[model samples]
Target chain A: MPATSGHAARPEASGPTGEPFLEVDRASVQYGSTKVLSELSLGVMRGEFVALLGSSGCGKTTLLRTIAGFMMPTSGSIRVGGRDVTRQPPDRRGMALVFQSYALWPHMTVARNIGYGLKLRGKPRQEIAARVAEMQALLGLEGLGERKPAELSGGQRQRVALGRALAISPDILLLDEPLSNLDARIRLTVRHEISALQKRLGITAIHVTHDREEAMVMADRIVILNAGRIAQIGTPQEVYNRPSSSFVAAFMGAENVVPLLVEAGGERLRIAAGPVNRAAAIPAEGRRLGGRVVEARFRSEAAELHSATAFPKEKATEDALVLDGVVMQASYPGGVWRHVVKIGEATIVVDSSHAFASGEAVSVKVPAEALFLFDATDCKEGEEELR
Target chain B: MSVLAETAAPARAAAWYWIPRAVLFGLLAFIIFGPLVNLLLWTVTEKWYFPHALPLEYGFSYWGRVFSPRGNAMGSLGTSALVACLTVFLSLLLAIPAGYALARLRLPFRSLILLALLVPNAFPNLPIYVNIARLFYQIGLNGTILGVVLVHTTHGLVYAVWIATAAFGAIEPELEEAARSSGASAFRAFRDVMLPLAAPGLMASAIFVFLESLDEFTGTFFVGAPDVTTLPLLLYTSAAGGNYQIASITALILLVPSIAFMFVVERFLRADVLANIGR
Candidate 1:
């Protein structure tokens, strides 16, 4: 594998008045023989919610723990508010971690759990009391001060865990799959609550999660990781629309994998799918030339499936984007019916308004811009690994 | 209709295993309790020889003599209680840290330490007593209550650590990590998360240590004689001196704590904890 370690410098401060609340500079972490992260670097602007999104073992959680000072990086340095905290212990770093399991002290009542960090820092009795009360009110844990963690429901336990982390008024809140343990319905509600809380407090948060949609909905920018390396870092919309690699494209929910060839010109690029995709125009230029179109992937929502019997009366060259296939199967998926159309040896799954019966001739209509093309070898490798 | 279905059902009686097990338990209970009852009968009776299956005579005369103001039995009871209490206390304090580390810490040499603990069990009992007695001569631990406690604790620490460590290890590590991340320091995390969770294990270990200290014969006989007369030592002395009635009474006395310890072990100590933890 080519080493793409050095790409861009630590992002420059946004004009004047911009200081990154947490900065991770070329941080690498290893546990025994496993290298969890390698020379990873990131910076979170003050109050910005950034989600480290990755499949498991992609070092997302390791990065979050390193920033929280739980796991010391083998190399590189971390700074919060321009102060180097590479050697500081977690409690001394002024950052709080909300664990995947909530980690609420089972022995402690909600109020005491919330006040524990303050007590550890040796705050005065009255001040600790005041802060605890304040946190209880803010978290809407008014009558729950006396309840032990075991007595609380999952959602309540989650709130208590958050309250405990927030009670200390941390500079940066570190959340490690904080909503992953909750049921799906409660997860959505808690995600909104956490996002609202982060915004209200104006606290920088670095959330690590495996769920891509959760990251998209909650984070201002999502950092996608692959293996022990970062694959892409962009705003959710930017990453969803224009993934740098096929890995990110699939991770962003573009499920349709098709093979295509890229023919590049001065200002425009044309892509031709191997009997699977219609030749479509993509906005690619200097960097995309000279590669055999081995594979392409499109979102299911991006392709339109039609019966091949309705193939246009025009010539194949004139309808360069049209392909013939037989509808193998179809299912009603919510808003529209979805069909799996088999084109000779290749199969493209597409969504359609009208249902096409099995064995019927069909053609998948893929808009030019919705298609994502990648190098054939890399595409095959990514697809195989995902499987 | 099918050979396979016909062959699947075995011809043997399903209840065949129960009868022998019930008979075995009955025999076991008799064997365990019969001696104690014989001793109880002998202590109350004046004399018994080969001719009579039952005691020849019964009276309160032996009990009166044993509990009389001039008797040495009460003094032996005092000595045994003091020594057992001290041994349990000291052994518990030592076992807590060792057990906690063995249970929770993933330290590199944990297995080595555990092997070292088992080393004492491999030593010959007589040589152990002689070596300990020689060491006692130098440190003035000779025949002293503290010396007896020290020896018992050393002998008992293995069982204590093994049992308590299993208990501590059975507690979920997540609870401790939760406490720590919730802002408790390492020490406080153990106190808050681990202590309550392992309470039954600690109690079980404590009861075993207490009973072992109380019933100790070889160590106390070598190191605690002439001065510290624990109940077990006193019973041994009476038995050796041909004082059958006093020996039987003392034996009965010794059985009480052991039985109590057995009850505690049965009720609270699930051997499953040890099985899972040791593996």
Candidate 2:
């Protein structure tokens, strides 16, 4: 990894205020012999919503908890506004966490749950009450002050959890998949509400979630973690369109893995003729392609389906991957017709407007822009460990 | 199935269901209230012969005699109440922290430690108390209120520690973490979230210790015989002296508080409160 990625992996991304408010300087966490979180360095700017995106056991939660001061980082320090707080307790750290389960005090009403932090700080009774009311109104929890957590619906409980986190007015808000408990229909509404609320308050937030779309829709920058190390950290556009590694490409919905043999080049790489794919050349002036054997991944919607009988030999020279295959099955999933195409021994999914019969031979043409290629030898070790 | 249900189900269900239910209800009512009725009769009976089915004379005079300041009954009741309270206090003081550790920490010998808590009850308590009394006698703790309280605490702690551990175990650990992230110190988090969540269970445990101490006779007699006069000890003496009325009144006194504690526990440990917290 480069020094820039080791220190600040984000590619020139800036928050609304253009200032780094929270800095996790090489924080690492270990559980006995196994390292759950390797040295992870990230600088979250002020008023920015940074999402740590990963699947389960990817150390995203550990990173969030370490930032929240619940877990101690084994080596590095965490800083907020240039103040070292690695040794501080969760209470002393200026961060409030909205737990996945909401974790509302069952003995207390919504009003008290929101006001609990204020009470702990020994704020004046009227001030705490006023702040609690304001938070409730901000989160649209009006007329639910006296209701216990059990009485509230899932969405309402989620808002109450958000309101409680906001009431403290901490420097950073830490969210641990708070919307995961909500139904899919309600999750969308809460997602937008949380994003808008964070922007409206201009408070920095670090959200931990495994939901790719949720992270894309809510965060200013997505920090994709894999195997306790940061695989990629960039804006949603950057990570989705220009992933750093094959692991990230597969994680970001590019599940169709196609192996290819390419010769390294400056402007255009010559894709060698293989058993599954034809020889072609793709633009590569800016891309960091290497090695003879390359792994190519494309999303279901990224590839085009066509008839294989009409072989366009001249199209191979263009900036696109042409794979010959036969359609195995097709399904209408809402608008697009999804087809399962068998390209030799490997099967891949491609979505097109028109449906192809099961036995019909097809061609999958993945454009260079939509196709993610990484060196097979460089990422083969990580590929087998992937879920 | 349809033929059986249509033809034979109703009569069989009625007979079998109602008959057993009625029998169980009768048995439960008798088992629960039968002793209380007998105690009531004994409290009011002024005079009775061996052959008499009921008390020949019933009056409120025994109640009056029981409440009299000069009567050992009132003083013994007070002593029993104090001893029970002290026992509960001491037992919980040890149980709460120990229970929290047992429930939350990943200790090496968790099951072994839990088994050790039951050690005081595992063996015959009579011989244990006899040895305890002998040790106390040498240490000058025998025949004092402290001696009786210490003795009762040994018994009280068995239930207290186990219940407290279970109570803490029943609460979600996330509640404490939530409190901590909400700007509460570790102690404050336990006091605010963990303690409140586990209160009902701990309350039930405390009530168990209280009742155990109030009715404790063997340990109390062995450790505090000459100086301490708890209601149970007083009842024993009164019964042995052939004063059946005083003994019955003392038992009644003991029963009132036990019933009251049960009611309190029921109200505190209502299902709705636990069902909704952090789920």
Candidate 3:
């Protein structure tokens, strides 16, 4: 395992040994006939930070709530420290959840809000006060302890919520998009603050979010959930660089997908490019591509666009793919110019440093390493039908 | 030209604003304050003949008489307070849980249940109280303070449930879930987080229940009369007997609780606090 300074050691590389700190085995949750989570399993080490990344209604929040014991799974079991806690309620599960809305007690002052859990546990008044003060200082809410939640700014209220969650000293910390409510500028700073705090405490944390950058920066392992199922789970760099499926590839900022026919030879895979595709031969690399059609995906920034008149006739590399297209639209989105290129019946957006006219013919060059290929039969439900 | 028009806008707007403002103020005073002034004057007046623009004479003798034991006003006042307080307690006990379920749970036939809660207030008071009085007689609860309180609570429950449902519905369930995740039990979460955050709405509903119970007359008359006399019943009997002074004094006594309740809950009635919960 690599020991990084402000981040946890990579959980995937650590490998499985003894029982994990938290184990969710084949958990499935259903709400009246609609299944929210289906046969999901995950294991988190003692001090690892894992992120569940997905779009809305993908069951990331459902999984978080189930792990926190707020929602009971219809089947399967959850174990914490080798003890089955499937039937236990949230209060007895030894975990704290920070809500996206902050969920601060609007009627109580900051000190009282942070001290509520201690008070419920019957801690001595002086001890509660001391712990509350410590949390306030840790979250940089020193002099504002007497102010109510309504008196604080959005960022300050978020800190108070974090302070309240941390003051309890739970075994696991659950955060459900806690920074989503903050403005973009505040979100960046708070993101670092929470990451630094989680590292400092070394508490096992599971953060659920839809923000790809947030997950990449804060989590030791990222679990991409699609339609209540795990699409892929790996280290941030691994998932970003090597997505396991077409859905995972599309989810990881590789939205442009092109279909191609592949014929597997002795050592190389011959790609039969279409009318707008460039023929290329690449090493099989152990990928199972038995299906005739393959879906090739790449990020918009990965493809370099140049005018067709200056394009070279021969291939630059054995793995590189070049495709012919015409610019359908072009616009500048801040730093770079983005062009929508029409190739055959499909359109893909590519980013360029220089501006190109809408009617100009161009060739898009995609490096081999930057491209991801998956069996077209494995395309997610409703996706291939649309194409 | 646009800049000049913008600069001159305030002067023209001010000239016409005062006219509408004065008319609104006058209408409000006439609609709300006129009856209150008349009621106050009738309470203090010793003698005021018909066609008199103002009372011919005024004194505190009626106020003194109402407080004396012979007047039986104080006893009725105590009865009204007891019934109203009990009604508030019982109504809240029933409404809070019902409201929570209605707002947060997926109960079957939810709209039907909500519509059923509104049935009590839809009908005339005479028919409802008569039926309740008959039911109380069969149960041997007629002419009892508990019976009167139960009757008042039935009326109060309808509005209480409606108001409480909206109140609890306005609160995000995430707030309570957060508490539960923080090592607090369900009851603790309700007590520490939900109750406080929903305090303003809950108090407003409770005040409405208290006031409704205090002002209820027909139910008290049918179910509690001849043995248990409440303030509203006393005021009705006094007015029916042509004792206008006593009726006025009884009305004033009933108004005191409503005023005190408003004062007690004024601080918690802040819109900012309620609107900003768990923001």
Give lDDT tens digits, candidate 2, residues A89-132: 98988899999999888999999999999999999999998999
What is the full ranking by lDDT, best candidate first? 2, 3, 1
What is the C-alpha local distance difference test score of candidate 1? 0.78
lDDT leader: 2
lDDT of 3 at A48: 84
Q: Say which docking band candidate 3 falls in.
A: medium
Candidate 1's error at B266, in angstroms?
Answer: 5.1
Cα error, candidate 2, residue A95 (Å): 0.9
Each candidate's B-chain TM-score, in sequence, is 0.88, 0.89, 0.86
What tens digits encode model 1's per-residue C-alpha lDDT throughout A105-154? 66678888888888877899999989988988887788889999899888
lDDT of 3: 0.85
Worst 10 residues of 3 chain B by lDDT: B270-279
Query: TM-score of model 3 relative to the true fold?
Result: 0.87
lDDT of model 3 at position A368? 80
Q: Write the per-residue lDDT of candidate 1 for residues B154-188, one digit (tens) a residue.
A: 88888888887888888766566655665667787
Return the lDDT, model 1, position B178.
Answer: 56
Per-model TM-score versus the true fold? 0.87, 0.91, 0.87
